[model samples]
Target: MLTLWCPSAASMESAKHAPVSPVLPSYEQEQHLHAFHACEQRHEAMARLLVVVWDEPGRCDLRAMTHVVTAHLRRHDTYHSWFEERGGAIVRHVLTDPTVIQMEPRTLGEVRAEDWQRHVMATPHPFAWDCFRFGILQHDRGFTCFASIDHLHADATVIAFLMAEIRSAYRAVLDGEGPLQLGPPGSYLDYCASQRQRAAAMTLADPEVKRWIAFLHRNGGRMPSFALPLGVLEDRYHAEYVHLDILDDAVMDAFESACHAAGARAIGGLLACAALTERGLAGRSRYSVVTPTTTRRSPKAFRTTGWCVGVVPIDFDVQQRAFPELALTAQRNFDERLSLAEVPIELVLELAAGLPTVGSVATGGVMLSFMDVNVPPLSAHIAREWHQANGRVYINQGIAAQVAIWLFRTPRGLSLTAAYPANETARASMHRYVKAFAGACRQAAEALMPTYSDAGREQ
Candidate 1:
């Protein structure tokens, strides 16, 4: 059974009286809401995961953590209204008493292998309507936390930002400072209204529509599906974050050199690797990669804080060309899609629905996957600080599919995280997949560099 940690009467009353404020509509927020509404129309739900990390025994402080979270909530105008609008969707409750647990901690690896499993299995979801719940678990050494956020509210990027903010607030409390104040901007509801107005004004040009129609007709008008390999299903879902260091010098020289030589951009190089991986694993020649775009294209929609984000579908052909050529092709398609990004993903999904569904052989009974690349304004310094302070961070953990590859550019290089169900394949296989992906990226870069002749002249 699920649990409802109802606020006290006074707390409830205070929440009711909380001032409503405006917020800016971020491109991400609007697109997310559009997708949510689209999925809701089909009676489907969005599921996400949040992982939190805590300090070793001497460092763990549940009371301090809670205080920080509450204070963070109080100071941020966006959160105040966000919670208020949802009738305070966020909850605070203890699973196990902190007084009984020691603050001194242990290593994260050991804690993850033991304490995390025990707590999650024992605790129920916190809210009845909550797509997921969060838990704070104490271990003999350190602590770890988990949350399953519903997809309707926001995507992973927003959740990550919120967790970082919570950690910062907690640290501030520890330092005897007040919580961080987030000024008012706009509301999500307003963003939705704005989206409708903008969408109405725009119509696909006959030529553009014809292009899409022609592409669909040529390709049999069906989207390909990605099936998770059956071998991986036995392992529980696990998340790991890995970084691909592209130093500033490398970024300016090697990265750009590789991209330009391949006729691809930074993002294109990454997508090309994804496309290659899909072909290698599934033995499919054609596939689609879903990339997200912020919906803050309209100045009016800026500052509105609802779920304004959309996913653009870029189809790639793996069969006809070399990986480098495919990379450039993917890049061209990606750029074209970006130009038309203002169209909400919901509308695109709706458009796709109009076409006939042509089923393909399922390598593992899954189809339709996405590779999300988020380069938001949030920095790694903040992410690391939050993870060190809190046991976990909230990220958009989309539903389990063949795989979801998340690449975030950091000061060190590129941070690559892959979330897949353990039951789907062996650890060795997954590891190989990651390696292949990395190798492909390197090869694509190398292919993009200018070749020199024996005379030392550029070819």
Candidate 2:
């Protein structure tokens, strides 16, 4: 639940008559194109992949489902937009027609859901058309609902917002309530226009730009990469996904307590563990990785469904430091870096010219993403419903040379999902990494439990 505002179909109908306009792409969108073209050179699809899977009790009515999905597509402007070249520049062309909503219906005869999902995920989206594919796979008792949207258009938060909308709309239609009267959705195009203005106002002397330059200089003019060997010499389209239940509620509670006692957010504990694990695995004293931060700076941006995310570089030493101390330090480092999260990576790269570009961008380097469903938007009350529905998100790691880890907390517990190159060497490395990470999590919680308990008693 990244946003509370849900747009209705009628709210966007007025835009159907507006003239088509070309908008400048955001930094994230530009990075996506860079990756996309790199993949094309290798005969692969660049994955801005997002997939959500859930189950419904009985066979869903295709016609009714169609109406609900159409409403969703019309609610968001990105769903009706695509990238195009206009006079030597890449721009997003937003369509004003409300009639064009992309939904590819498919029935699973005997094909596995995972296989079908991966197949659909690997195919490149038509650049001139809507980059969304929604389908239903019917089986005996029920059907699985699958939705995939290109990351260029929607991030995880946007996907969550969309899924919730669909669920509510579908349920209403089934119960004869029809469409809910959701508020008008915010336009991502407007956000992009503001970002362009922000970028225009920035200079090489800006403190944020200087900070980014220093960060890149520390890592040899590029973003830091995974400390350990991934055995990936080049980009490969195939990737393996792993999901593990890292911690149950009790342990997660302890972990949170420990983090709080050590003056750090719960995410700090995970970052500390990541640093230690990399050190132990590769003897690299410093842990460096790129992380995504939400750039929903204003209320309108928060309500808008688009890639409102920015990348930040984090680096810290993990040598001979205890979990709690390291966690605090990691938190401090994260806080300092987050202040500049709004600075576009494209600008950073431009200011720090002549820098080696290999393994520098977030897509080419190591990345860590964490989502706490217990927090706002995706709070436990809503998370409980999603868990009961067996809702899951998937990422297609097409043409990636690095590992990206996603950690999420649901009502059930803390879980880890990772995507890496789908080769034996990389798989083995990721497995080892996950194992070490899990152990680190428990160790951090156990090590700080006594102090946490004592503090609680004093209070």
In terms of TM-score, the best-performing candidate is: 2
Model 2 bad stretches (over 4 Å): 1-20, 86-88, 99-115, 122-126, 235-238, 298-303, 355-363, 448-459
**Segments in model 1 whose C-alpha atoms lie over 4 Å from true places:** 1-47, 54-64, 74-148, 182-186, 199-220, 227-257, 260-263, 277-287, 294-307, 316-325, 339-341, 349-376, 383-403, 408-435, 445-459
For candidate 2, the per-residue lDDT at 1 reads: 5
Estimate every model's Cα lDDT from 0 to 1: 0.46, 0.72
Worst 10 residues of 1 by lDDT: 94-103
What does candidate 2's lDDT look like per residue over 1-459, in tens digits?
000112234433433434456578887777776667667767875556687878777877876787787778777776666676556456665666666543434444566647675655644463535456676676787877777777877887655556677877898898999678656777887778888888888877899988888777777666666665677765343677889888877678888888998899987888999998988888888888877878776545555678888877788888899888888998898888896778887867765565553224433567898888776655566577688878888776656655789898777778898888777887888888988888788777776565435333210
Candidate 2: worst-modelled 10 consecutive residues by lDDT? 1-10
Per-candidate total of colliding backbone pairs = 64, 0
User: Quick one: how many clashes does candidate 2 have?
Assistant: 0
Model 2 Cα RMSD, Å?
Answer: 5.9
lDDT of 1 by residue, 384-447 (tens): 5444554334344333333455665543345566555544244445566677666666555454
Query: In angstroms, how far off is 168's CA in candidate 1?
Result: 2.0
